[model samples]
Target: MADIHITIHNKTFATATEPTIADFTLSLVSGEFVCLVGASGCGKTTLLNIIADLDYDYDGDIVVGQQHKSPKIGYIFQNPRLLPWRTVRENIELALPDDYAGDVVDNLLDIMQLTPHQHVYADRLSLGMGRRVSIIRAFAVNPELLLMDEPFVSLDPPTARQVRALLLQLWQQRPHTVLFVTHDLREAITLADKLIFLSANPMQIISEVLVAIPRNERNNELAVENFRQQLLNEHPDIKQLL
Candidate 1:
């Protein structure tokens, strides 16, 4: 399986002398869905940016598949960053290799349930529809690693729940390694195979929780409620923040 190892001996911003993510080390195996939960200003987004190669000033060793091979890494942000001038299909196609565009775009549109609105421009779609399009666009290139930063934060609870289900279904189907960052504890528990808890400010991993429950059993009402309560009791700070 493909693997990613992130080792941060020390990382401090130029503006601030304090280290943001210190001694942060973790390995993510291919096809595993891991969630990182933390309070605000905990460097969650900063860490993601480093992983995505958007921030290079940090001091650390981030090794993916033994070497940096320009592997495709897809990122889905809180807002759907679709080009307003592009159609849903066009947006998804933009992520595909030029030679594979036509076939890949159609497949993604169907997979994302956007076939009916494939020709619709970004501005014409609803928020949920636009988010779906964004997801499809990210997955179209068959990324080795998928990084998400509170992708469902703006949605209502019910909508977020639906999106969570959709994400799980898609993960099962495509099986890409995922590193999701969120402030929502339930969201982290509901979707992650492994959970990494980060402490407030100058964030560092405080705990790693392995989820033993089968993915198929995650949504079972009784099991979910019981697990939720257990997590709440175990992590009082997290519960209090929520």
Candidate 2:
């Protein structure tokens, strides 16, 4: 487990006039589940990209673990991003280190209920199933830091619910420092230990709310709704951001 400190001085596109991120600073505690929620196109994905080291054009400092040690990062994009020609197991194995045991993959497959479909090709899997493979792939690496970008988007209600439950199950089993990006307030409320709300433009955090609901009760619709209503009632300004 590793704590993270991120400080972005400024991030701007060459074609743009204003910076997308300016003087932003955030931190994640080790083994904590934090969600970043904001309106669409508010640079949420860009922030995740920066943290994942997929983009480095911005002027910023990202320190992972103690003494700025580099930690293994696992990123799950909105799309599964699995190779269409590869079997689910093969696609997951692609992320494993050479010395890693194959049983780790097998364990994750069974936990995510993908054991039956492990041999199926990615092209033949449904969106929800593909996302399951992606999640398994990410955790198979046993990453210290995990970045998720709306991994549950565009699924039907039932499928999305199932996936969410499975995700939480995996998370509980191995509590990695998670930075999840989502626009769905209800989902955020259900999953996050803390919610960080971002402003529309310039991509800065506007509010930080600690989820008061217990982990066991987070799945209860009534409990989640009560917590949401309480949050809105206390912080009315955050309603628009959600």
The model with the greatest lDDT is: 2
Count backbone clashes in candidate 1: 0
lDDT of each: 0.81, 0.89
lDDT of 2 by residue, 93-191 (tens): 998878889888888998899999999999999999999999999998888888999999889989999999999999998788999998888999999
Q: Per-residue error at 35 for model 2, in Å? A: 0.6
Q: What digit string (tens of lDDT, one per residue) describes model 1 on residues 1-242?
A: 48888887777888887888888888898788999988777888998888888888877887778885434689998899999999888787777777875766676667667789999999998888888888887887788888999898888888788778877877787788999998887787789999888885467777788876788888875776778688768877665344
Candidate RMSDs in order: 1.8, 1.2
Q: Name the regions of candidate 2 deviating beyond 4 angstroms.
A: none
lDDT of 2: 0.89
